[model samples]
Target: MASPLDRGGLPGHRVSVSPLDTAAAARHVATTEDGQRLSLAEQVAQVPTDPGCYLWKDASGEVIYVGKAKNLRARMKQYVQLTDDREKIPLMMQLVASFDYIVVDNEHEALVLERNLIGQYHPYFNVDYKDDKSYPYIAVTHGDVFPAIKYTREKHKPKTRYYGPYTDARAARETIDTIRKVTPICSATCAEWKRVRRLLDKRPDDAGIIGLICAQKGRPCFDYHVGRGPGVCAGMISPEEYAVNVRRVERFLSGHRSELTRELKEDMSEAAAELDFERAGRIKRRLDVVDGLDDRQQVVFPTSVDIDLIGFYREETIAGACVFAVREGRTVRTCEFIVDKGLDVAEDELVAGFVKRYYDETADIPAEVDVAVDLEDADVIGQWLSAKRGRKCTVHRPQRGEKRHLLETCERNARHALMRYMMRTGYADDRTNQALLQLESALALDGPPMRIECFDISTLHGRFTVASMVVFTDGRPDKSQYRRFKIRTELDEANDFASMSEVLGRRYAPERMADERFGSRPDLLVVDGGKPQLTAAMRQLEQLGLDIPVCGLAKADEEVFVPWDDTPVVLPSGSASLYLMKQVRDESHRFAITFHRELRDRAMTVSVLDEVEGVGPTRKRAIMRHFGSMKRLRAATVDEIAAVKGIPAAVAQAVYDTLRA
Candidate 1:
């Protein structure tokens, strides 16, 4: 018998309702761009009675939200009947022009597909975790003859084992350094290896060359002399010998400490029995390193216990989640995530969604998962995790005992994480409210500028000119509302004023003003320059017939220039008002420069490809699509370049040569 969690067993159908037949019920529905509409009743009637994922799209056909349901028709009825009490639901319904769904085998498949689609589309109404930093990982190349352990942020390569998405980059680097000391693995690209390579280059190539090199008996690197590296570069160790150390490092990192310690002890004993005191001493050192690492881990349970505890601290529409990964009775790792709860979602739903998303990216899965809140579908999530782990797994909420106590501790850490995030982003604090008030008094505004917009222009000479608009709501960045513009006006030289004016005109145009995505007009407008930029912005607003307050922030003197005054208002050095201004200004500048660099680099890549013979626009595009960037293209060999469609071997050679040059 097939388990309920089985996926992709049979093809399911897609259900969509046409809008033409539902004209009588159109009052309850939003219309599409092509005069098409579907009433909530018609939508609910057409949905099939099956488990699946549904996508709610806006009139512009953009997916605004994605959800899963055990019964599609029943779920549709709930939305149509306006039963969900989430504050954003009513607004979402107003914007939802249409919805469609894909039937699946069961709720397990629905859950999997929903998480995938959410990750793919990043629907606005979904709970998306937004963190700018990419955690570092300890990566070991699996296919290399003598594998090397490395610290990397990216994990896209095939046949590579990645151990972590460590929250602390310094800790990841330290782990790699420690592994190098204990494993004696050779880093082929290190300075010591390169020095050895230079010596090999001066000698004639022969079958016995490595043996002859090793016969010299001189240490090729400091690490070799210090016993931190196998003398692979000096040809003192074979690949087979080096692999033993590599496996030891892998076992140590994989949390198989007991087995690794046992194996090390056996090796040490064998070495001593053979009268090899030196090798036995080396093995003893490795055992000490392994034991030292184990000693640092906090013991949370008996040796048989292995579990993961997830705790959350939510405030309004945002939440901070912390994970404590326990293995072999000790807490091995901790990770933190920040979730943007766009709607009023329940804590149980939040926990389930987070577990599914978090486990999807991680390689390790424990036998049990303890969450801060009880889940409605704990069994379903456990089934999914069990399938993922190829073993039985359980998801539960602890009621009492050490697990509950530890869970409370995890929640406290989660609270700290949230507090740190609030402090870092200047969100939801008395200080932030005071900063807004300070700005209001300093700028002599009628009220606090609750919605502040800052504009900045970036360019290299006269090339790839761009403008950015950054929004701050309630004294914190509202990144979703941020906008970027490419300066359409051609200029012989960089013109900050002209760029600023063009961007302002485009942003406040009548058509854009009516669009809901732009939201309400900003309470304050700030340009990233002095009087000239401010005057240019003011002129644009006057032409548009708008009376919003405008100001300029000059970077040179850190002075704030208002349209009503000639002398700049110098905000107090340590004032929150000045700090807020700097934050907004710096963010806008960074956003503009990032966009500008994207365009500039794209142009540079095309121009560089143009230098190669027989490489036309089509071929250049194919090459760019294949490699994604100029750095990757330059790293490609001639044969790899030839693999791109529409390019011949000769042209590939030419392109490769040009890129290298």
Candidate 2:
């Protein structure tokens, strides 16, 4: 369902694979600490920070688990920390005495390596999708030159254009039908056709040829086209037309949809214009047939044309970066980066760092590299990449339009990817329990809360009071389904009831909630505080004539506050519903804190640094550049940090001593 790099970042940027790459990582799998061997920590530290695929081999040198990571160090570290009883992982760990790897340049390369290795080795842990019969492909025969439609499970062999690994036989059949009507090709084997042609050419004083043409020409044949009428012969397509059609099939297989559509449209127009009403109707029908097949094409995005764009961000102790491959401004591939303590380096520098260190030795480089985020000197970096590529490489940030959307999508994917990476490495949790599940079970509802909405209000003397409503479906927090509301009741500090009431009144107002796509009338509603908060929410919904099930999650004992319930319903801590509630509660708390922090930090920032004349962008860059971070720069020395560019020696010295003092 997800790509191999969806597992994580590959070594640096070269997403290629080579043997001996795993040797270094294997040695790092276990390290000596305090006279005792601690395999995990040592393994994490020793993993090469290059792009590649890693194998987990048993004592017999058989690969058990294969994986890829953008940062081999972090990924290996994650595996090192797999202390839980994941059956396959633990088994693989015990069997894996060593490993092998092939380093490549980027996550996509890593993905290719992983898939190839899986196909080659058929590792035990990986999903082995059997049923060769189910994978129906459209194959063109090499010997025939004008190949017939054949269902197959084979890979794309040389000299033959294999169109699919189609999941459904009916779908494949429909495709074949569309192809037959659109192109001048026959489904019968060339041998059968040639034999029919020989008999016809000889004009062997027989009506067989006429019968065959009539049977097979306009109507279907024994392959379910004709229902035992005069048997049709498999000899309609002329040899030349068959050859031309075969080429068309190749174009169709190779992702030339627009070309196929254009040809179909032309044929339809010609048929109609020629006054061949019957033929014109047939052509128009064929055009409609092909139009419906557009979704089945391999290339989903219609406008993507380029290879990739890359971006990065650094925060506190973690650095995040994403390399988005664009095919016509649509992201077809992405590589995420997470580096620890990489604060001083800009994301563009990191991108440039990866490109230079990687593609410099590789043969593949995309035409243009777009940066969603900026670098200090983008043009210089672009020039560097261009020189290495031996082509005019242009790097630009999108101001607006589809490019921006591409960048945003890439960023969103990168965030999800980084989260996935962290989850894999045990740095974070991925499992989400639906908060509605807990509410329903605790309330003894008819079914799992299909739509459970939780409301939480945060305020400081009612100045920046805001309420957030989060939705959960099937016991999981669906953040995309969440909403935030700014309080506007003109109430004083700590007026939690009015804040709750106002938020509810706006959310359920018919005009707003009536949008079918956002048809989020909750099966259950939950407020974050005790009885008073729950009552306020319920009264507002009641006044609005919405009879939604309402409850309160008491912060004190984390008990459920329900309507007409005297005793609080306490769910088991380990129950699925409780787990869902915990997750939603935690998320809301996080969201609230994050919003509050932004507001707090805005006024709390130290303005003294801004007052300094020498603290321009260049000087600031130099300060952070040499010292590695703002924190370190603040603690730097006048002469000890004097090497920084743009900063006066006196200013550098003063900055260093001032922060130190």
Candidate 3:
């Protein structure tokens, strides 16, 4: 809420107007307090003609929208003159009580600052590119002495390598399993190595320690006995030898098949020359596996080719974007994104926004990027990318060639992805339209509720309480707008009414109303309970001075409760309106339960370890990493628990006693 002059180092100005007077003010005329009429052109003429970012705020001083422009004055003039023909502009202007701008040095600076401000404020009117599902990745813990290759959806760990954010999660998991089968790193072996390595680092010439460790021949895992793993646990494979296998797995996942195959063949030859027939046979098997994988990959270009292709397909306000990551002439990975374009932006602007956001998160930046649409600021974006990659990067729009054909293929894939999403959500169906109309008549509202938000509360024995807000637009669920809340109020028992009131109060608060993630105000509000919940919701809205329509749907009989009527309105069992209501309610319940369960699981994991006198987060993590899971930890003996790195014998005994108790 700081004044424009107080924000950053940029010189700017603020314009204020009354919300009630916005209709007349939309004509580009404003009446000052002294009764002087100032035309919008005159007002815009005073703004600096520099590239910058602008912010529009509602009456409560919350930022509702943020945008960047090459010329600040021209952009302001377009808004004032009502020449910006975006569908949402008129509605957004009506809510605009004031506006401000921050001038930047260049177009690229404007773009960067605009993105940062939008992320910080989450302005509602900005285009939000959100993925409904988290794609899976194959992660390798390269920081460890004996790296563990695993399938993961999250990439939070530092000093680790992640590859293939595959759209097909099952395929990613299968790949990880196959790699583990080819190059197995035993967990027991890793634990022992960590322990010995720590001791050796502190005492270099401890012969007694080395001799004692070397004297014990540890039992090998099942994979080692089955010939699928190197016998690291059985002392047959040294740490240096185990690291070679880890490097091979990393190379395989990184799409370096040619180099890895050559190296493996050389290793096999050396093993054969040394008369190690068993080792040579193992290397030969690995080489065949690598060759088989290489043959399966589809090659679209020469071996030296490395580039990324981006294509998009937009229908109405929703767009699906496809990214093809080509490495060493083959398609190594593919990524898909669903974008909600709140405004009717130009195709080139859409492409620019998508490129910036995508590359910002991705670690691998190709030297060349080909897009379906031609961008005006391609050079600026390329410069930004080059700085990020520490090398020269180029952005291009392929006209006619094999690259164009591949780009077209990527666009086709994007279209198919959009179609799949449409089919799954039943978006814009005739039945959905009929349902909206029916609901409007049944609820006695002004018009069909195009945007509906439903709330549900979930808790288990008064623990890990949570709430979910699910949004439905045009009778189709909009997962991007969905939000979860962890209830902060302390409660001795389950209280749905109080929980509903608290969630509604928090959601409708002035600050939350302007957040981009919350989206626009819902046409109607639905609560998952009976009359009491409906009353609670209505009361909260009334306290906040909000006039959104409120209703409650009871699960017992599917009865809908409205404030004016004492009797519950129950639509026909097979009616479309009833079905839509049930869908929204069920989705809210599912979302809330999922969030609650995640909290409960995480708390259980931490709480069990927290009860031990000497165990903290570090030692707890060590215990979990050593044993893999709580089930195995519980089954482990005291001596086994004490063997984990960083876990002292006294602390391990305390942890064992706590779990046993």
Candidate 4:
């Protein structure tokens, strides 16, 4: 581990933190939320060039942002000279009074610590990092007498051997089928075996009843005949034999083809020498099949490093990303996500943004992230990955060689996924178009509901008030336009109507409303509750002088409420328009509840010491005695704050910086 002090004087690293250039940082600090007068540049200069996660705190000692860097000092410097076009950065900067960091041993450790702290703190500006969906892993119930090997959409369950979110579900099924053919392991659906013991009581012990129940060919299941599939029927494949075959299945799934084949070949020879001709013949056939499969998987990378090839395909409102897991230089697993109404950022920016969020908390970041699109923060992200993996990770654009070929394959898959996605939804699906048209008529809007915004509030008896604004563009989620808010007013009071009003006011405030993006008219506005919510929004729009169409969707019966009417405009129970509203409302609810939980979590972690800088009990009492409330002290100017007994001018400036931001 390196020293936790400045490493600016050392060699081979960019020392972003330089001694306080008071003129540059102090002025900016005063206008920030922290209101503290510490020179950020100076603070950066003091930060050691070490692996760690940095926390940006505001005047109230609230963590506003969290990020990790291999070189803490250098990363801090990057922020001090911010050219952040991601509008939120400027807002976050305004509240950043002071910065703190946790040093760790390596980059991988830093990644882990960073994610842990983010979940713990829930910083205001940090994007909520959650894997929206998890892929299927073949969960081999190793703990059971009958180890059921099947595809599971969930990840991480105790006492199970899981392999390959494996990308393509079809490919995984095919692989499992092939493995079963080679060595028929018991493959039974949970439902098939759920009440076997109870059902078996009526059957005779002498009859072949167990096999009839478990091994009987059922539809396209068992992959092979009952006897060949080694279907774990009552008397077939003992626990010992089944365990042996399960190990082989695990090896093959993990991409250890060569080693597994070698072991099989040795076993076949030994069996033949022992005069076990049938067993030897079976082994020979299985080995040949495994060898043939390996031959088809031509090695891509010359050196056997596991790398993931990532590719992107975007057109207009739809974009797709494909990730190909190259294990031992073979493309083994493939997965994709089709993003609807994604950000209108550049190709590289899109790739960078997706990659960051995709593996932001993934502990298993590949050593070489071969991206088809050059990442904007390749070096920074690579450092973070390297730290997470406990080894240096290389992230760069791959243009030529085998790596490039793999990336091209990924791009092809991505394009296909996007085409399939569009085909299933958008213009190809007449129902979607009908739904949008129906929504417009149902809400009596000016035109089709091309863009609809929905609001939902979530809190526990109004404690951690949070609201989510979810946007739907052309009847599909426009995630980039979504926003979450921590309701700052009326703390300790549960007021949905009031919170709804505040969110609307801040969302469409005059200054922000001037921006075309913010001002562009939403075709429809749907609130997640009934008359009271609808009235609140209707009155808010009147106050803002905006004549936007608004309605409320109550869950009790999927009823819609509009202004000037107590009776809701109820649609058919099975109407498509109602479905769209339900989706929008549900999405908003999910978003709000998620954000609210984070706020509650952050509140739980805060301590009184977080509010003041360099102030202990003695100074705390003196300041409290003089100002009474912390809010009163925050309103004081630097000189007035300095005038307090036991307070220094520098500390007073820090206080001013903290309070103002």
Q: Which candidate should be chosen as best, given TM-score against the real structure?
A: 1
Model 4 alpha-carbon drift over 4 Å, by segment:
1-51, 54-66, 70-81, 85-88, 91-106, 116-131, 140-148, 155-161, 166-168, 183-247, 288-306, 314-319, 327-329, 339-367, 373-396, 427-661
Q: Looking at candidate 3, what is the lDDT of residue 474? A: 87
What TM-score, over all chains together, does every model reach?
A: 0.56, 0.37, 0.52, 0.45
RMSD of 2: 19.1
- RMSD of each candidate relative to the true structure: 28.1, 19.1, 27.1, 27.6
Tell me how far the alpha carbon of residue 585 in candidate 3 is from the true structure, in angstroms, after superposition: 35
Off-target runs (Cα >4 Å) in candidate 3 are: 1-91, 97-123, 130-132, 142-147, 155-158, 181-251, 430-661
- Return the clash pairs for model 3, or none: 122-516
**What's the lDDT of the predicted structure labeled candidate 3?**
0.77
TM-score order of candidates, top first:
1, 3, 4, 2
lDDT of each: 0.79, 0.58, 0.77, 0.70
- lDDT string, candidate 1, 236-332, tens digits: 7766677788888776676657877888899899999999999999989987887888878888886557799999888655788888988788887
The full ranking of all candidates by lDDT, starting with the best, is 1, 3, 4, 2
Best by lDDT: 1
